[model samples]
Structures are given as C-alpha cells and as structure tokens.
Target: MRIVAAFLLLTVFAGLAIFLTFTSSWGSLLIPQAAANEAAVAVEEPTPMPDWEGKFVVETNQPVVLRTDPFVAAQAAGLLRKGEKVALKGCDVSGLWCQTEAGEWFVSYMVGTLPEGLPVLEGVKVQAAPTVAPLVPTADPAALMPTATPAAASVLLMLPTPTPAPTVLPQAIVADAANLRAGPGTSYAIVGSANFGESLSLAGRTDNGEWFQTDGGAWIAGFLLSDPPAGLPVVEPPAE
Candidate 1:
C-alpha cells in the first residue's frame, strides 16, 4: 500500500508538469506584461515619411553635380543648374541624397521645396524690371541739409581703413588612399599616391570638368575629393 501511494503521488506530479508545458497561460506568465505590450507597439508602428514634397527646386549656394549614384565618387551624370527644378523620386536614409524621376541623383541639401504659389510646369520668363527715377531734393530742402565741414572731412579721411582678409583658395584633401595621376583622366599614368586628409592646392580642372589638377602637378578625380570648397576658382585644364 505504501509503495502504491508513493507511485500515485509521482504520477500526479508528472501529469501537472506536462499540463503546464503545453499551457498558453504558463508561457504568458513567464513573459512580463510590459515586454508583450512593447513588442505589440513595435509591430504596429510605421516608418516616418521623408521631409521632401513631390517636387524640389535646385537652390544650392553653388552648382551641384548630378551623379549616377548617391556617393561623391559616382560618375558625374550631369550638372543641375542652380535654379532648375527636378521631380523627387526617393531619398537615401541619410537624407543627404535624392534620386530624381529621370533616374539621376543629387545632393538633397542643395534643393529646396517648390514654392506653393509658383506654377509647376510653366517656363519661367525673365523680364527687365522698369526702373524708378530717383527723387531729387528741391532747393528749399537742399538748404535745410547740413554740409560737412572741411575739418570733419579731413578727420574722416585720416581714419585708417580696415585691411580686407585675404581670400583663401580651396584645397582638396584626400579622404582615402587615392592615386594622383599625370592628367585628369585615368588613362594618364599614376604619379603618386595621396593619403587620407592629404591637402593639395588647386591648380586647374579638366576640359570635361570632371578632374582637378593639384599644385603638386598631380591630377585627382574631383569626385574623389570632398565637395569643392566654396569660392574655389575653376581653371582651364592644361593642353592634353
């Protein structure tokens, strides 16, 4: 009888363990309620949309290049005029590049939203604005104006004029190991290697305007360098 009682107790416990293993309530109890709610929230959330409207107008501070890809090293597909308009297709996650309906890509920051009041498809016509004539003071009004004394004029002239800051020409710095060639095109022989952050003075640009020549007499692909610094003058390339 004692052995039978011990065996019955063992069987009861085994059945209870098997029941809990298959029970949904047992699994739910194992997971915190907060965790389950958080997971449901994650599944229901949607991705945020891009900031751009359907159309974008090129309003760059400087001319921007349209590229085959979103990266700077991509081939120069074309140039987007400063005020040209383009249809927005999509943008990269970084929001730095936008692809156009024509399948070309450009920097997104260079574009601005099309003004709501402007016509979307109309060609812009620029007309010379009528000039307004300057108003001249009458003799009576001119008499009331104070004239500068010769002594005051001399004092103003003696004041030292501030010296203007010298213009700093744009320099190209290598972002990675890059080949410096004898000419802008890759067909030219490589003359040296430019290490990361190596600075080179601007010399000139290729006829196609795709490559830059350094003062060091080495040519680097313009796309390989960071965005050409503002105010960098474009020089004519040397005769090939």
Candidate 2:
C-alpha cells in the first residue's frame, strides 16, 4: 500500500513540472513576437522618386557658358555649342536655367531653336549648316569685248574661263567694346564703335590678332563676355 501511494505522488509532481515548462515556453515566444510587431509599426518606409529622362534642343544658336551658380561670375563651368542637344535629367522651374547630368547649369537664352517634337533616349536631330555650291563660269560684261582676230574668237569660244570670286566667310561679333579704324591698330582713327557682341564681317586680321574688315561698315564692340542677347531667333540663310 505505501508503494502505490508514493507512485501516485510522483505522477502528480511530473504532471505539474510539464505544465510549468509549456507555460514558460509559450510566454517567451509571445513576448518576442509582440516586440517584433511593435518595431515593425514604429519604422516607416521611404517613398520612391520619379525617373524623368529626355533629350532637349537648344532654341537659340548662341554661345552659352555653363555656370556653377545661378548668377554669372560664380564659376567657369563650360561652354555649349549652338544647336546642340542636351540630355536633361531635371531642371529648375524658373525656366531661367537647366542642369545637366554633370551638374552644370546653362542659361535658356543661349539655345538654338529646338525641334517641334520631343524625342526620348534616341537620336535628337538638329539643323545643320547648308553647303555652298561650287562656283561656275560667269560672264563678265566688262571683260567680254567682241574679239576681232580668229585666235581671239577661239579664246572667246573657250567660253572666257570664268574666274572664281573670293569666298566670303562667316563674321564674328565683338563681344566687347572694340575700335574700328582705318587699319588694324589702336593708333588708327576710331571711325566707328562696336558694342558688345556686334556682328561684323571679317575682312582679315593682323598677325598680332587685330581684326580688319573688307567692307567699310561700322559695328559695335565691347569687353563683356555674355551669351547672345535674349529674344533674337536663330536666322536661317535662304536656301540656294
């Protein structure tokens, strides 16, 4: 009878021990899960940004310098060729400036006229300069007198080989105050004044870098380094 009573007591103690072990395990798991849920609620996720990429055409065919700051004289960044295409990542809403992928700012006024449609990631076509035609034989009435001799008639029959006219080159404007004189020298009388970025036909220049003119025309010159003035559209020469 004593042995039976001892076995019953041991069995009850074992049952109690198992119950306590299960309860402790359940509590530990619940606490960790609750803590994890709280941490998840406290942390917030960051929002994603938009991706905008496109090619833009320069509206004006003017020389534009890229700047580090919005205002001029901040820092010498770079120069943009006229009628060049730029890949725009983003821009300032003021419409006064645009930023390149390299983090350079360029003024809006210096752009050549952009194409009517916008293109993405592909080739952005731009206007190119026209090619001049080859010079042909032209009759000079002053030189063309009726030949009396057979040799002269034969020469005239050769169609009076036309002489090529001197080719005219594009002129550079004075970006600053420049003096127009009888010759390419400061000592030459200042017949006219050239203001900033004034367009003048280049006659020729002295070896010392002084510019001259073939035609006796006056222009404005200056010392200021600025992009072409705003509001002037790119002028396309008439087609041949």
Candidate 3:
C-alpha cells in the first residue's frame, strides 16, 4: 500500500510540472504576438477631406481680390466685397484656391459656407479703373496766324475729307428660346427669358466663349445665338 501511494504521488507531480512548462512557454510566445496584432489593428489610415460644393460667402473684414489665374501674382480680375455671395465651381488639389462659376479665382481661406436663414451680403461694389483722357498738343501762336496764300487755302479746302473707320457693335438675335441667367453659366438661376428672333445687345463674353452677357445684365448661352461680333471684348462675368 505504501509503494502504490508513493507511485501515485510521483505521477501527479510529473503531470503538474509538464502542464506548467507547456503553459508558460505558450503564454510567453502568444502574449507578445497578440499585443502586436492589436497594435497593428489600432493604427488606421487618416480620414479624407469632405468635397465642398455650392455657394460660399466672403467672410473677410475687407474686400478680397479675385484673380484671373489661381496664383497670387495673377491679374486682379475683380473685387469681392465682404459678405458677398460667390458661386463655387471647384477647388485646387490642396483645397486652398477656389474657382468661381464665372471663371474667377480666389483664395479659399477668405470664404466660408453661407448660412441658411440669413440675408445675403449687400453693397457689393466693383472697382474699375478710370479711363484716361487723351492729351492734345498745344498749338503755337505763330502757327495759328494765317501764313497761307488764298491759292493755298483754296487747295486745302479742295482736299478730300478723311473717312472715319466704321464702329462694329456686337449684336445677336436669339435663334431659339433661351433662358437668361443671373450668371454666365447654365447652373445660375434663370432671371429672364428670350424668345426666338429676339435681338439682344452683347456687352461681353465669358472666358470660354460659351456664354454672353447682355446689356440688360443677364447672361445667355452663346450657342443659342448666331455667331458673336468679331470685335467684341471679352469681359469677366461678376461672381454670383
């Protein structure tokens, strides 16, 4: 009986030792691997920026200049007043510069989302450079005196008068029924309408030549009209 009890105790002790060794080795190896897997799962990719579209308001204290190009050194195409509403066309890859539907470019930092239930900003003013008067040469007092003979005066009077160059004003007749919009693009709100055979005075054209501004301050698609006048100046449509 003593021999049997001693063998039983030895077998129990051996089994306990094997179980502890196996558990210790597995815990040491698997615990670090589990921690590494959890850490890898916790590290995630960054979130992307939201795609912004629609009308944005100029939130700056002072007026901001809209440029013909996206860069700072580009020509000042127009001025955007504080609290004015501007239609956003798209933004650069960095989302810093935004282009208007009218094709004017401005910095995105100066603009903010237009809030609902608020009256749109007013007193928006455009600054155009004053036209300079042509200088006239002063006439000499001696030259003013009648130094020519009667025959010379007769010959000068007989000389043919110079013909003036013809001025060509841009005009267009609507070939089809068209919608006159507030801005140069079709996305702008329809402010007026044009019937077939309606004649409109052309003031300017959009940069892409796809739209034309009428003398009535409305925009119409150029494709709806006959070919525009050859000498008409291209003007930048105001940002809506």
> Roughly what TM-score does model 3 have, to 2 decimal places?
0.31
TM-scores for every predicted model: 0.32, 0.27, 0.31
Candidate 3: worst 10 consecutive residues by lDDT?
121-130
Whichever of 1 and 2 has more TM-score, that candidate is 1
lDDT of 1 at 110: 53
Q: Write the per-residue lDDT of candidate 3 for residues 1-240, one digit (tens) a residue.
A: 999999999999999999999999999999999999999989977898543454543454334567776554346687777666665656665455667778887655556743343332233222222232344555554564566687699876775655545434468987656779999765579899999788899877666455688888899865456545433456777776
lDDT of each: 0.62, 0.50, 0.66
lDDT of 1 by residue, 1-240 (tens): 999999999999999988987796767876787798988888995789544564653455434567887655556687766565666666655454667778787655456753343332222122122222344544454354456588698775665654545535457777545678887665678799888677877756654345677777778766557654433335555456
Scored against the true structure, residue 55 in model 2 reaches a CA lDDT of 50
Candidate 2: lDDT over CA atoms? 0.50
* Candidates by lDDT, descending order: 3, 1, 2
Ranking by TM-score: 1, 3, 2
lDDT of 2 by residue, 114-135 (tens): 3344322223222122223444
User: Which candidate number maximizes lDDT?
Assistant: 3
Q: Using alpha carbons, what is the TM-score of model 2? A: 0.27
